[model samples]
Each structure stands twice: as structure tokens, then as C-alpha cells.
Target: MDARQKQLCIGEGFHNIDYRILKSIVDCIYEAVCVIDENGIVIVWNKGAEKLYNIAYKDIIGENIEDIFPDAIVNNVRKTGVSVENKYHSPRENSYILANSMPLYIEKVFKGAVSTDRDFAELIKLYFELENANSKLIFLENEVKKISGVFGNIIGKSPNIVKKIDMARQIAPTHASVMITGESGTGKEVFARGIHELSGRKGLFVPVNCSAIPSELFESEFFGYCAGAFTGANKKGKMGIFELADEGTIFLDEIGDMPLHMQAKLLRVLQEREIVRLGGEKNIKLDLRVLAATNKCLQEMVRESKFREDLYYRLNVVEINLPSLRERKEDIPIFIDYFIKEFSTRNSKKIIGTQRDVLNILNEYKWPGNIRELMNVIEHIIVTNKNGMIQKNSIPEYILSQAKKSESFKEYPLDLTKAIKKLETENIKKALKISKNNKSKAAKLLNIPRGTLYHKIDEYKIKCPK
Candidate 1:
């Protein structure tokens, strides 16, 4: 081989073998590979380069690379005898590459430069696609946050309250019937409204108080009577609660109070998804969701045949039970703050906050009336108070009397060690209660490590609920 071809070999010892091996190695590489001589003439161009640049090796071999690729990194390496590592380059419009060019030297003579380029066009396309997908995901998350904000009215961050709110969000998007069970004044209607808002149903939310509707007027009130169907009916006819809530949600408040006779008709409407107006032959279809709330134990009533078992099962597809105020006392302080601000704004008052002693007394008292009682108490304070801060005298006498009675029953310990141990055990128990006996969550609530919490539990002989 002549001197021009000999330069392609790495060294004299393995000239033929090394030249064939190097050629084979370059051929195997997927990245675009190009080599130029000291004069910037193209000597090696692999198939990758041909596909990337749309230039054939046979047509470009022995030609000046600068004439075809003026911005090529190989030309720069050949001129400067310097290496370029992982540099980004754009050879033409819509073409991008990451290239690494190294100066080739044999016997202290700069032979040429070798470059390998990775096409970045596909990578850029994928990056844009990922960015678009991320934007859509962020939008969906924001929408969910907006929907969840409706629950902000329910208040309280206790584990029980949080679990109920989470369960509400999970079932809101589906068409399943939800049964909200809690004590009276526990804000069951608030939960039902929040669910309807998140359900994506466009129709109005029609609330029906079963106890308030007379049994004689149940059919006409629920399924509107047609013109002349009744002696005093409107000539144009009227829409009943079910028809008014078409394509929306029907909140059956006090569902347990519905008479047994009306329960069968309601069940038929739910199963048939249609209702016939009184004296009307046509059956009007309904596309609606049902949400029910009750303060009574329907399960026990079902056993007694007071509530229809079949209707009970149909409405109780998913049950969300709200905790009473006494069950989540940790949230009372915030509840106080929320109600104070709400009443203050409505009543045009600037009550800054409640006195610390007043808060202590309020916290100690068990709120049997739940959030409704708390709201009433705050409203009473806001309305009667003449000063900026809520004082003990401004609170109702009933609550004050109850708090004094509760304080009289408490005992105090003088020993420092014993007091400390008692306080620790009480706090640990409170943490366990708040976390629903989840050891990890309880430890977090107590601001202690899991191991330390376990040790304390064992040392105090505390019984954790299952």
C-alpha cells in the first residue's frame, strides 16, 4: 500500500490487522463517523454518516470535506490539532447533532481528525412530547385541586376528617350513589353539596327533606302531576324534584324519614331511570345521580323493616361517615378561628381572637352538637362581644358552667417526675387516637421516632387500638 493508504493504519506492527479492525469497528458504530486527512480531504465515511447527512460515502470519498460540510468539527480539529468533546452543533435547518472530534496523530505528525456525531432530532422531538404531556398532567392536577377546594368548607384536618374527605373525592367522579351518615348538625348537607360540585353533572342540585314532605303529596311533589291531573294543578304542569334534578344530583336529606310506601316508588325510579308524571302516559327518562344523607342508623332500621332493605342497599353504594366534633377535638381551635372570622366578616366586627383562658375552657368542653353548636357559639360571641378579643364573660353561661364542672373533676400531681410521666402517657395516647392507631402516623404526630414511640408505648403499657 502507498503512503496515503498507510496513514489509515494505527502503527507499523499491526498495520493490516489494525486497519481492517478499525474499519470494522467504525462500520459497527451506530453514530455518524467521519475522518479527514491533514488537507481536510474525506477519507472515511460510515453508513451512519450517509444516512444522517444524506450523502453517500462513495460520492464524498477523496473530496474536500470543507466543500460539503463547511461547519464540520472535523475540519476545525484538523486545522487546530485540538479535540472537541461532546459539543452541540447544527449543520442545517431541522438537523441537530452532538459531536466529539479528536485529532489523529502518528509519529508526532497530525494525520487528520476523526469525529462521531449523534443525531439529536429524535431526542428533541421526544423532549417536546414529554413537555406537552407534563403540561396536560399539571392542568388535570390543578382541576382536581379546584374540585377538592369545595371540601374546604367542611374544615378540620384530623385523620378521620381527612380520610372522609379523601373518600369523597375518590367517589365524586363516578356515577355511584353515596350515603353520608353522621350526627345531626354534622354538616352532612355540606358534604353532599361538595360531592355534587365535583361530580361534573351540569344539572341543578335538588335537595329533598323526606320528613317535611307530606305522605299524601309525595307522588305529586316527587313526580309532578300533569295538566288537569289534580283539581288545583297548574295547566302547564310542573316538574317534580326528580325531574328538576335531571342530568344533575338529587340530595335526599333525611332519607331515613322517607315512608315505606314512598321508598318503593323511589326504588322504581332509580332502577328504571325513568319517571311517569301523574296522569301522563309518557315515561320521561332521567340521567341523574343520587346522593343521600341521614343522621339515623339505617342499618338498624332496615332490620326492623322501617327502611326498605333493597332501597337501602341501592343508595348505600359508598358510605362516608363524618366524625362528630367530640371525636376530633384537636381541630376545635382551628374551628374556632374559622367561625370567628366568618361571623366577624358577616356581622361587620373586627374580633381579633379569643382569650387564651377562654380557648382552654372551650377546648375542655365536649361539643355534643358538633360543628353546628360550635358555629352557634362563635356567632353568639361575635354578636354579643363589645371588644376586639373574645372574653370569658362573652361566652354563653351554659358552656362556662359545663367547663367549670369539667375542671372540678380533674386532679393535680405535685411530684415532678410523676407529672412528667403522666403528661407523656396522655400525649402518647392522644397521638395514637389522632392517628387511628397507625404507629408510623402516631409517631409523626408525636414528633418522635417510631422506635422511640414503640419504647414509650411499652414503658407506659399503653394499649393501642386495632
Candidate 2:
């Protein structure tokens, strides 16, 4: 009978009413509850307890509790001669049932233990589902990347490179505009491509070299005009980068060199999400990702009043700074192996091996143009290699020259620009003569970085025939 019914039926003669009161108290609890006797006979089972273990009091009252539910009793309580409790599981629904047990004493000695359970199945279910979904998304993301842009993903296992890759992956799936800052040739475009592919936007990667474009062509190049919008315009108007990249990415390289007036126009388009062609009357909606890259220190430019502060803030939401090749020297070996293979296959040359001294020359030398310079060096070496393995002597003279003139100065003095130019020239000549008319080897011989040597050769108006 129910507690209230038994109490009213027995009246003053109800001596076992205390058990009814105990049952009522335990029944109100949220978790499952079970009270067992010395012989492990279940004496009391609460309502919550019944739902958890799929057992009722009527079925378990006279039954041996251990036979029906040994796990439910918490065996530790009996072994240690003390009341014990812990979390237990009911695998039917893959549920977690927390069994909180304590000693039950009939006299001065402990008789049995009473256990209670709290269901934690819901929380466990949610976590597993979230984990599974995340795994699937990551797999699909990798699969989709293969079908996108041809720009290869930057590869390296070094700590520095891995961190940058992780950060790129984290921010790629968002709509936020990105500002990438790095030294020239430090794989800025690679990171930009990664962001574009991750955002799930359609279309292509349209690269605009800000410094390469003339000031007059900026508007026409960015936003295409209508067929009859301007004089001398083509009968069939072309789609602008902004319109062409309607649902894709537009990588603006050398953004630091973009004129101030154009910066304002770019900022306006970003804010309105629309662009107007050079001589067009209507505004075209743009849904493209804007990824800007710069080798110059933009913050310093902002301080010098060259770059606008407002424009900086607008594109500063997601900023990534790429590490220079010198900063990640550990990645040099792997990158060299990659580039060697790349160039060797293309040039039909068999470059069997690279000596440690050659790698030392590459690693120790400052990489001003970063990976691009290194790749070019690898291509040059492979194309000019007479033997299967390139030895220290066979390597570029510019690198060998550094060993000879290593003691020129401990530091490069900025004030002595004339002395610097003179040293640069002498070194360049030695590299050229040693390499036997090869600018690539001569660049390595001088100990001066390759890209800087290229620019210097151009500045001095020296001709190195291809």
C-alpha cells in the first residue's frame, strides 16, 4: 500500500509507519534510491530508482539485491566495512548514473548500505555528438581544399610554422577581412589562399599587385565600367576584380603602396559591401573576401602619416604576422628538400644530394626574400649542376665569399651607406667571377642575401645576361 493509505488504515496500530515516512523522503529525491538488508535483500526502492535501473520495489522487495543489481549496491562499501559511494553506469541508454551510497545501521553495528543515483546521460550524449560532428567537419574541410586554388599549401613541421598553420585554419572559415603582415616572400599569399578556401566562397583567387598597377588604372581595374560608360572603352565591358570575385577572394598584394585616395575608395566599398565602376551609374553588390598583404610595417606607416588610421582599423579585425625565413631556420632543411625535388623534376636534372656545408651556407645566410629566394637558389643549382652531388666548391661563389670576408664587420652600420655599397659591389664581383658569369652563384658568394643582391644589381645598372 501507499504511505498515506497504510498510515490511515492502521491508525494508532501502525508501528511500521516510520519505514513509510523514510520511503516517502527517499521517493522525492531526483536520483534513483535503493535500501538493502544485511543479506542483500532490497527493502526499499524509490520512484526515481525504479526508472533508472528499470526495476520496481514490488519486484525487488524480497529478492537478493546482489543477484538483481550487484553494481547498484557499490561493492566497496561491503569490502572495506564502511559506507562507500561512486558514479555507476547503466549501459542500456549509455547513461551515467551516479550512485551515492552510505552505511545503514540497525543497531550499534552497520547492517547494509543505501545507494542513490543521479542520471548524467544527457550531458555525456551532447559531448559525444559534438565530438563526432567536429571530426566530420575537419575531414570534409581537408577534402574540399584539394578542389580549390592551385596555390600550394605551405608545409613545415617546425613549431613556429605549425602554430601559424593552426592559426590560419582557425580564422579561415569566417567572413572577417584579413590583414597579413610579413617580410617579402614569406608565404603571405599562401596564408591568404588558405583563408579564401576556408571561407567556403565560390569563384577564383584574383590577385591584384597594388604596386604593379599604374595610378590611372586603379579604378578601371578594381571596378569594371559599363560598355558605353566611357569613351575609348571596349564594346564589351570586362568584369572588375571586385565583381569577378563576387563570392570568392581578392588578394591585394603590396597594399602599402596603394595611393591614399584609392585607400579611401577601398574602405568605402568594404563598409557598404558594394562597388561602383569607373563610369557606371549603378552600384554592384560585392560578396568577396578582402585579403590584404604588405611587406612594409603598416603600423609605422600609420605613425608617419602615410597610411590612414581609419582604414587600418577597418582591416585590422583579423591580423596575422608571418615569420621571416630567418626566424624559422628549423624549417629550412625540409623546405630545401621540397624545393630541390620541385626544381630537379622540372629541369630534368639528377641532383642526388645536398652537402651539410651547403645547407649551413643556406641556413646561416640571412634570407631577405625568404622562401622565394631559397627556391630560386635551388632551381639555379639544379639547372647548373655538372655532378650528381653539389659539393662546397660546386655551390655558388656568393656563399664561399662569406667564409673569406666573414670578418668584414660584426654589424652593418646604417650611417655608412657609401661603405656598404662599396662592400656590396666588391662582394658581387667576387661571386660573379667565382661562379663564372652566374648571378645566382655570385649572389651566394657575397654573403649578401640573394633578393637584395638582385635589387642592388638592378640599381647599379649592372647587366647579368640570362
How far out, in Å, is residue 279 in model 2? Answer: 2.0
How many backbone clashes does every candidate have?
0, 8
Name every residue pair that clashes in candidate 1: none
User: What is the C-alpha lDDT profile of model 2 across 295-402, one tens digit per residue?
Assistant: 998899999989988998888788889889988998898888877766665555667687888887777777777998888878878888888697777656776677
Give per-model CA RMSD: 20.1, 21.4
Question: TM-score for all predictions?
Answer: 0.56, 0.55
Where does model 1 exceed 4 Å of error?
1-149, 411-466
Cα-based lDDT for every prediction? 0.85, 0.75
Per-residue lDDT of candidate 1, residues 326-443 (tens digit): 8998999999987776666566566656789999988988888889998999999999889778999988999999887777546437788887788889889998888999989999
Per TM-score, the best of the predicted structures is 1
Candidate 2 C-alpha error for residue 460, in Å: 45
Q: How many Å off is the CA of 456 in candidate 2? A: 44
lDDT of 2: 0.75
Q: What value does the lDDT take at residue 252 in candidate 2?
A: 92
